[model samples]
Target: MSRPSVWAPKIVALIKGGNSSAAIAQIKVAPTVKDLQDLRKLLIAANLLKPHPNVDAATNDMIAELSAPRLHRSP
Candidate 1:
């Protein structure tokens, strides 16, 4: 778990000390798009991003396309 104190130590301290409003005011419930993009970049940099492919479905689609008959035109 990430240390809650990293972003707002004073807010965390206030919460532990039972100050609700101040803690709530200091807390960020939502991250910005930039923050999400930065996190994605970080995960990619750490090689932790694993993308899985639907191999069977892809293969079946390819086979279907390949098996479809092609029409020829006379010159």
Candidate 2:
């Protein structure tokens, strides 16, 4: 199994400390989709964020955009 990210502890600390705005700012620049997904799970688990269809749709869209193959033109 892979080790948890370093950011996980920091973000969780933020959540626990009621520093959601800082946590959200960190989340916005999460380096990977996995990070974003993990943070979302954390937020939901902490009851700081509620599940919603729009949020789900936005997550799916972000995943799609980030994972989609990029087209490269031959030089």
Candidate 3:
């Protein structure tokens, strides 16, 4: 599991810790085109980053636990 202080957990918390309609109706939660493009670019760059062998093993173990029914689905 990811540490509570980590970015992954923070992203999950931000997206899940709210009511959908209430959040959309009462708060400005839209991402602008530029904002989305920037995020996409960042994700692409991150995906292209080299994976260390040790990190890959650890990530594989974590993903196996998370996707028990489809271990090969993830990259």
lDDT of 3 by residue, 1-75 (tens): 843223333322333454333322222332233333333244345552133233223333444444446546656
Clashing pairs in 2: none
Off by over 4 Å in 3: 1-6, 9-44, 47-51, 69-75
Give Cα-based local distance difference scores for all models: 0.39, 0.64, 0.34
* Cα lDDT of model 1 by residue, 1-75, tens digit: 753223333433454465645544433331333333343344355433343123223323444544557576578
Q: Residue 68 of candidate 3: its Cα lDDT? A: 45
User: Which candidate ranks first by lDDT, i.e. highest?
Assistant: 2
TM-score of each: 0.29, 0.55, 0.26
Candidate 2 regions with alpha-carbon error over 4 angstroms: 51-75
| Model 2 C-alpha lDDT per residue in residues 3-69, reported as the tens digit of each score | 7787756776776786766766665566788866776676577665553434444545666766778
Best-performing candidate as measured by TM-score: 2
Q: Which residue segments of model 1 deviate by more than 4 Å?
A: 1-29, 51-75
Pairs that collide, model 3:
none
**All candidates in order of lDDT, best leading:** 2, 1, 3
TM-score of 2: 0.55
In candidate 2 the C-alpha lDDT for residue 13 amounts to 79
